[model samples]
Structures are given as structure tokens and as C-alpha cells.
Target: MMLENKVVAITGAGRGVGREIALLCARHGASVVVNDPGVGGGGEGGDAGPAQQTVDDIITAGGKALANLASVADPVGAQSIVEDAVQHFGRIDAVVNNAGILRDAIWHKLSLEDWRAVIDVHLNGAFNVSKAATPYFREQNSGSFVHFTSTSGLIGNIGQANYSAAKLGIVGLSQSIALDMARAGVRSNCIAPFAWSRMTASIPAETPEQQARVERLKTMSADKIAPLAVYLASDASQGVTNQIFGVRKNEIVLFDKPRPVRSMTKTTGWTPEAIADELIPAFRPSFARADEVSADVFPYDPI
Candidate 1:
């Protein structure tokens, strides 16, 4: 049992990816807290049915779980959710920051309200839950955080400015937390998943003849994305942190770390024209691949 005796709290566990993760964790021997406010895809208020349903499913599968009906967007509520996990299961060993909402629009057409609502739920909600769990993790001297980013965040997507920004912010946050928690035996990583979740249901099929093609391309199941997450949260990945992975059907690609390129040294000032003509080119998009240049040409030197 990879997660024997572990305690995991997952936000948005009422449905979709979060629910899948909760079930998997419980099956591997973890005591799970399925947290959700039962909100719909648009983030509207609702009952706790979704969360309870997940719990019932887990119990039926012979797994241990508790349903938590709390809004991840509320810091107080998030804190209480963690407290409930500790109260029921003794300690929290991991957290899956999987709660999110979407508001899609092109850059110029996006309203302030639309942007704020998405950012509040996706980015701020991650903060609320992670902030509450950090103390517990530090005290235990070990923990794992699996944050859900998206391909829209990694690359870019039309009609998703708000969602992309929020998801990218989570990746940055996860990296920083990885550094802060390194010595405490904690690990943090993000996953950019391509899965068939409720969030992508509205994407239009480009042509009637291409309907099957569209369905094929969009039908990567939530279960397919969970194994990588499970590995990251388990003990096998103790040495891995501060990384991002793109997971889809039968494929997992590691994202590259950011690197600097094209350093220029000048002992004297240059004219604006020279700066524009020379410096700009050195920093152009083409220079991004300069890291692959022959290392022998820039051999290590001691001064």
C-alpha cells in the first residue's frame, strides 16, 4: 500500500479529477477528506451532495473517507477543513489543491467580474488551503502538495486569459513552497493535465465530419492523469520537488526549468540606437535556445 495509514485532504473532491484522486488515495490505504462546496462548473452555491457522494463511493469500496462541505475559497473554511481531517484521522500527510472554476473570454472581451471570479476561486482558493496545511506539514516534518495546473497555463489558450493566469500563478507558488519546505521533508509539484473533465465540455467540435476526431482528442480520462499525481504524493518521489509535469493519455512529459541566455558585458555606455540594434537582438526569442550552444566554447574559468 503506497499510502498506508496516510491522511490526505483534497479540495474539489466532490467530482471530476478531485473525486478520482480521493478514491485512489483511499484505495492505497489513506484516510481521505473529500472537501467540496458542491458548486457547479460556474462556481454557483449548492448543496453538499457531491462531496457526500464521493465519500459514499469510497466507503462502498472498503476505503476510509470523510466528506467536508466547505468552500475552499474561504480561508477560515479551509483551515477548518484541515482541522476536521486532523480531528478524524490524527494528522494530514498530503493535500491535493484541485479546486477551480472557469470564466472564458478573449482578452479584450473579458469583464473584470469574470476575471476576478475565476482568479478568486482558482488561485486564491489554492492559497487558502495550502496556507492552512503548511503549518501542519512543517510540524510533522514531512508532507506532499500536488497542485493542479493546466495546459492552458503552460502554453496559452484562447478565451482563457483568467484561467491561464491563475493556473500559472499556482505553478510559481508551488515552486516557491518547494524551496521553503525542502529541509522539512516536504515536496511540492504541479501537474498540467489534459483530461476530459467538466471544464472542457463546452469546446465546440470544429466540423460535423470531424466529431469523432474531436472526441478522440478530448477524451483522455481523469483516471489516466492520477497515477503521476499519486507517485508525486507518495514516498517514492522523496527526492523530487520543484518540478512540473504534463500528463495526458499514456504520456507524461517533464517541463523544462527556466534558464538564462545571452549574457552581454560592456564596460562603457552605448547609444540608444546601438542598444536597440544590438541588445534587442541578443535577447530576442531566437536567443532562447542559445543554452544548447557548445559548452566548450564557453568553458568554465576561474578568476
Candidate 2:
């Protein structure tokens, strides 16, 4: 009963990882708010069935739950999700910014429309919900935020320029929220999860490598990510914030934040030519492999 008497609002809870987290949170005694517009993988069209189904299941299991068919991409709709939590449950304890869509295209061929679409849903959507929930959290002097990031941004991926940028931006957002809201007893953290969800199913499998990677991903289920997410939302994880974690099947990993790896300085700062001659060679060995993708970094089978 880690979350007994608490209320948790989860975006994208209609299906996949988000759904699992919502169910688990409810089972652990939290009154759950399952929010999802039921949009497609690329953020088109919508249905209310998904969110309602999640709530139905929770209630059948003897748990408290509510459904919200609001698009996280809209600020007003996002605000409604939080408001619904407070209006119904009387208080809100956690917000999980898990709503997202994928619009994959190579950097050059990626259209402005596609770029903005991805950012609006992933980056701006997270902000909208978090911003709306902030005042409530601040006033209550307690709250938790669990944001969904991805390996495509943390490591690398092909034909996902917009997605990568949005996911990485979420990391920065999580860090800032954690720092700025600490005095309010609020915690924020990110999870870069690997699972065979609708998002992964949409990845292009044109290449042999991609097909292989997709096959590998099929072994990991969305439920494997629920435990960590529930823990983050609960009081048990009181001191854990401003961190990044990865969950792949049976494995859980703590990721290091960006930090200076190597440094070089000249007593008198030199010209570009000097930098080329001195800096390039000194940093050559430490340079990250430009060609490495998520699969390349995690070549081993999911365990």
C-alpha cells in the first residue's frame, strides 16, 4: 500500500506502459486518473474507449479510478486532467507525463510540420500538464512527476530527428522541475524505457538491422516498466529525483547525466588553427561514435 490514500494522474494511460503504471498504482491503493485521448501512433484521430477501458478494469478489480479523454497536447485539455484529479479524488499526489507520438524522418527530409507535431505532443504536452499541476503540488507541499524519455534521445537512433529532440528536451524539463520544486517537496525524474509497445511497433523495419532490432524488442513487455514507475510515484522513493533510469525487461539501469569528459586549455586562448592542431588530437579518442544507434549501444539481448 505504498500509495494508499494518494491520487495519481497518468497521461497515455489508455494502453501500453502508461496503462500498466496506472493499474499498478491503483492496486497499490492510489486513486488513479487514467487520461488518454486514444490517438494513433502518429497523433491522429482519437477515441475514448481506451481510457474508459482502463478505468473499467481498475474498478472491476476493486480499485478507485477515473477516465479522462483529453489530449495532452492542448494546454486547456491538459489542465483539465489535473483538475479532474482534484475535483474527483480531493487531492493529487503524482503526475506521470507519459503521453507522446512518433513522427520519424531523417534530419534533412524531416518537415517543419512533422517537427512541430512531435514537439507539441511530447515536449509541450509534458509542460502543459506539469505546469497545470505545479500550483497544486506547491500548495500541498508534496508531489511526484514521472516523465517518459527514450533511448533514441539518450543514446541515438536513425530517422527520428524530431523524436530525439523532443525526448531530450523532456530530460532538461525534468531536471529543472526537480531543482525548482525541491523546496515544495516535489520530485521529478525521467525514465527511458524499452518495451514492445505501440511506439516501438511503429518503427520502420526496412533495413535488416532494423528488423533484427524490432525482433529483439518484441521480447520485452510493457509491464516490465511498471514497477519502477510505481516506485517513483510512491513515497518510498522520497529522496530520488532529478535522475534518469532505464528499464529493459528484467534489467534496471541508472543513467549518468551529461558531464564534462575531458578538458583542455591554453594559457593564451589560441586560434581555430591551434584548436584544430591541439584540441582535435587530444579529444579524438574520447569522441563518441557518430554512427552508433540505440541497438548498437544495447546489442545484447533483453534480460
Candidate 3:
């Protein structure tokens, strides 16, 4: 009953993590707008059954729900989807920016088309939906945004330059929105979820060993990632914003933030030799550790 009477709009709700989030929200008493473009993992458009099916399941369970087959990559479509939620539910309370596409390629092999396709859907898609929902949230003086990021983006994955860049961009976007909406009672947070979904179907299983790894990963179902999302979308997370969370199985981990390791004094008459001697140790990657001697030692004494 945490989400009783709450109205939430979820992009990519047709299947996978988005679908699970919609179902969980409904189970807890939310009225959901299940939006999906019916696109494949690569963003090719197709049928609308996925979104409709989720809505049907929710309604069957005695929950309020609606289906929207709109491309979040399109600003007009994104706006219309939010408008539909407001028109049907009479208010918009939360948005899950979960729609995305994958275009994997090494940096040199990556085409402009491949890069643009991923960016358009994942990065621009979040922007389109968030922008459309912001006015309503501002007007209502309350809203929550759960933006989907990925470990690929957080830690950098192989052959996913396009996908990783777009996902990381969502983190920056959510943080900025969180700061902007602080006083408006709107909260925005990023979720890096490790769930076995359609997005990872292309992972190969050529050998029994490979298949075993895949099977192990499958244990982290999409359903397991939904509860954290529902909490973030509810009133319980009002004080939580501009944060990043990693969700998998029964564990939820918050990612640590970055901070400057050492501050150097740039003084006049300092030569390249002086810079090499003093700053080189500070520039070492190990200096990133707070407990490292170089990081703990003050390179320059203050007057």
C-alpha cells in the first residue's frame, strides 16, 4: 500500500525490468501508464502487445493501468504519452525513464549510425520524457524520476561505446534534474540494474561453461530489480536524490562518489622539473586511493 493511488509512467514497460517495475507498482496500489515502443533490443519497431499485456495483467489484479505505444525517442510522442497519463489519471506522480537500445561495436568499428541510434533512444529518450514530465511535476509540486543507467556505463564495457556513453549520460542528467527539482518536491535518482533481460539475450553460450555462466546470471531476474525502483518512485525516497544505486538479486548497493584526491598549488616560477618532481607522484593512479601516501602527503605547504 506504499504506492496507493500514485500515478506512475514507465517507459519500456512492455517487458524486462520496466514491466516488472510496472507490475510491482500496481501491486502496491499505483495506477500505471505502461509505455513501450514495441521495439527490439536494437530499436526496430513492431507490435504493441507487450505494453497492452502488462496493462491487462495489472487491471486483472484490480489495479488501474493503461497502455501507451509511443517512441520515447520522439519528443512529441513522449509528450503525448505523459499527456495521456494526466488525462486518464488526472495527475502524474512518477516517471521511469527505462526505454533504451543497444548498438555494440569497438570504437574503431563503430559507425556514426550505430552511435546515433543508441544515443537517440537512450539519452535523448530520457531527455524527451523527463522534459515532458517536468512541467507537470512542477505544477503539481511533486514527482519522482527513476532513470535507468547500467554497469556498462558505470564501469565501461567492451564493444559498447555507444550504449555505455548514453547510459552514463543519464546519470549526469538525473543528477542535474534532482538539484533543479529539490524544492519542488520532485526527486530523481539513477539505477544501475543487473537483471537478466532481453537486452542480454545476444550473449553467446557456445560451450557448457559459457552456458553455465549465463544460467547463473539468469537468477538475477528482472522481477528482483523492481522493488527498489518502486521505493524510489514512492514517498519513502523523498530525502534520497542525486544518488546512484546498483540492484541485483536480493542486494542493493549504492555506488560511491568521486572526489578530488589532492589539491596542488600552482605557483609562479615553477618549472617543468618542479612539476615532474612534485605532481608526478600525485598524478599516479594509486594516488586516487585516499589512504595512499602521495594522497595523504601535502605537496605544497601553505604560507
Candidate 4:
């Protein structure tokens, strides 16, 4: 019962990794707030069924939980979610920003609507919830935040520019929060989970072979991602902030902090023409090819 007597509010807990995280946190003796507007993978349409069902399951298992039907992108809705946790459970010790939506489109074909929709749900949504909980964390002198990043963003993916941008932005936001809240005993970290969820189910299989890969990946359930999330939400991960961790089945990967790999200098300065001629040639060998995608990098069996 690492999280005994603690309350953790999880966004998008209606399904996917968020749902698993909520269930695990409850099992670990934490009061849970399952907040999800119950939107589809594309962020279209909403239902209350998923959130309520998760809450019901937790209660049936002899755990404390409440259902919150709120869009994480809505500042007021986000604030009320945190308030509800406090009023019902007395205090919130952790916040899991797992709410998100997908709007996949290649850069040229990506519409303004698609870009805004993803950013609103992912980046801005993280802001809304974290901002709402900041004062509470500070007042209580402690808290934890586990924000979701993605390999799509960490590496690169074709047709997911919007998603990649938002996911990477969450990492930047988490790191800044870790720096700000360190002295208050509050910590923030990011998780780049590689789990099979509805989103993966949505991937179009153009051929039988492609379809088989997706089917095999189905075995890598969202449950695998929950353990690291719960650990980060508990006192066990205290001071383990500002780091990015990955969960792909049983494999746990720690990404190095972004650092400069190469530098070019001139006693004076180099002109754009000079950089193009000199720097480009000097660094081109180290630059990752634009065609490389997530699958090429993480070829391990998802199962």
C-alpha cells in the first residue's frame, strides 16, 4: 500500500493506459478520481459510461473512487476535477495527466483543425490540470505528477506531426514543473509508454502482414504501462523528477537527458553560406535520417 491514504486524480481514466493506472492506484490503497469525458480515439463524441464503469469496478473491489466527466482541455472542468478530489478524499497527493486524443495527418495534409485539436487535448490539457493542482501541491508541501510523453514524439513518426509536437511539449512542461516544485517536495516526471490500446487498434492495416503485426501487438496491454506510472505517483519515486522513462512490455528504458552531441566554433563567426558549406557537411553524418520512424528504432516484440 505504497499510496495508502493518498488521493490520485487521473485524466482519461475511462480507457487505455489511464484506466489501468487508475485501477492500479486504487489497488495500492489510493483514493482515485477517474476523470474522462469519454471521447473516442479521435477526440470526437463523448460518453459517461467508461468513467463510471471504472469507478464502479474500483468500488466493487473495496476501493475508494469517484467518476468525473470532464474534458481536460477545459480549464474550468480541469479545476473542478482537482477540487472534487480534495472535497471527496480530503486531499490529492498525485495527478496523472493521461488524457489525450489523436489527429494524425502528414505535415502537408494536416489541417489547422487537426493540429489545434491534438494540442488542445494533449499539451493544453496537461497545462489545465497541472495548473489547477499547483496551488494545492504547494499548500500541502508535497505532490507528484506523471505526464505522458510518447515514442512517436521522442523519436519521430510520419503523419503524426501534431501528436509528436504535443507529446514532446509535455516533457518540457514536466521538467519545468520538477524544477519549480522541487523545494516543496513536489516532483514531476514523464512516461513515454509503448502499450497496445484503442489508439493502436485504430492503425490502418493495409495488408494481411500489417494486420498480423497489429494483432500481435494487442498482447502488449495497457496494464504493462501502469506499474511505472503508479510507482511514479507514490512516495517510492520521490525526487525522481525531470526524467523520461519508457515502458514497452517488461522492458524499462531510461532516456538520457538531452545534451549537445556536437559543436562547431569559429573564433569570429560563420556566415550562413559558410555554415551551409562547412557546418552542414560536418554535422550531416551525425544527423538522423528523416525517414527513420518509431518502429525502426523499437523493433522489439510488443508482446
Candidate 3 residue pairs that clash: none
Looking at model 3, report the run of 10 residues with the lowest lDDT sum. 294-303
Residue-level lDDT of model 4, residues 61-85, one tens digit each, is 9999999998988999999899999
Off by over 4 Å in 2: none
**Among all candidates shown, the one with the greatest TM-score:** 2
By TM-score, the better pick of 1 and 4 is 4
- Candidate 4 runs further than 4 Å off: 207-213
Any residue pairs clashing in model 4, and if so which?
none
lDDT of 3 by residue, 1-303 (tens): 889989999999999999999999999999999999788889886679999999999999999999999898889999988998899998889999999877787789999999999999899999999999999999989999999998777766567889989999999999999999999999999998877888877656688855765676677789888999999999998899999998767778788666676667866766799779877767775454432221122222111
| Per-candidate TM-score against the hidden true structure | 0.88, 0.98, 0.89, 0.96
Task: Tell how far residue 183 is off in model 1, in angstroms.
Answer: 1.6
Model 3 local distance difference test score: 0.86
Clash totals for all models, in order? 0, 0, 0, 0
Put down candidate 1 lDDT per residue, 191-218, tens digits, no spaces.
Answer: 8876777777755557763354347546
User: Residue 103 CA error for candidate 3 (Å)?
Assistant: 1.1
Clash count, predicted structure 4: 0
Ranking of candidates on lDDT, top first: 2, 4, 3, 1
**Which of the predicted structures, 1 or 3, would earn the higher TM-score when compared with the native?**
3
lDDT of 1: 0.83
